[model samples]
Target: MAPRQKTAGLLDAVGPAFSRLRRSVLLDVENPVPAKDLTRTLVLNIVEDGADGEVTVGVVAERLAVDPSVASRMVTDCIGAGYLVRAASQRDGRRTVLRLSPEGAATLERFRQHQRVAFEYITRDWPEQERLEFARLLLKYVDAIDALRAPA
Candidate 1:
């Protein structure tokens, strides 16, 4: 096949590949933590990233590429689930920021563990070097995307 076609095929597959991964139960196996949807995972992750700076609902919206109201509802859901807490920002007491509750941090860690397990299981048959390279490249790809979306 031509190089352009090969690249197009790869790009075309990415969406469905991500969609399937999102819907997969592999990440939820063993039930390490209380059941929460992907949205909560995303919100928790965003809050964790905020360890370097104050994170608000608006920040969540921007990070999630969602509307402010939508992010508000999602953040509220996270708070209700006890995974996040609303607190006064240290930089500006009048502004509210988000923090991960103790349970939230543990839950996120558990999720990461399960994700690693799932990835290992899925690629169990691949050559070890290939698996390691894929893991490194995938992390690099995701980190690059995150950096692009990061707040200015």
Candidate 2:
């Protein structure tokens, strides 16, 4: 097979792999993580890692590529779940910003640990160098996507 055809085949496999990964997480009932939902993780990550001065619902909406109303509802859910809190903005007391609560931080850490465990378990048979290289490439792929999605 030609190189281009091989690449096309690889890309074709990626879609199903991604779908399966998504479903695997949803089907993960054995883990007792409360913040198992992807939206919760995303909202918590945005508040924890993407905070710049003030992270508002608008910011979440923009970052999540979601509608303002949808972002509002999601943020509200996060707040209700005690993963996030609405606080007064530093720049303007009247304005509001999102902050990760202590529980949010702990939950994020636990979820991340859970992911690490899952990765290790799945790749336990792989050689060390191969596992490390795959991890590096996966992170690079996501970083490239983030860069491409960022506004110029």
Instruction: Give one digit per residue, the lDDT tens place, for model 2 in 39-135.
Output: 6988888888665658999989988899999999999998998989888998899999999889989888987887887788778899999999999
Candidate 1 colliding pairs, count:
0
For each candidate, what TM-score against the reference?
0.85, 0.85
At residue 104, give the lDDT of candidate 2: 89
Writing each residue's lDDT as its tens digit, candidate 1 over 1-152 gives: 99999999999999999898877756456554344555588899989988466999998998889999999999999899899998998889999999999988987887788788878788889999999999999999999997886669
**Candidate that scores best on lDDT:** 1
Please estimate how well model 1 matches the true structure, expressed as its whole-model Cα lDDT. Answer: 0.85
Q: Which stretches of candidate 2 lie over 4 Å from their true place?
A: 25-37
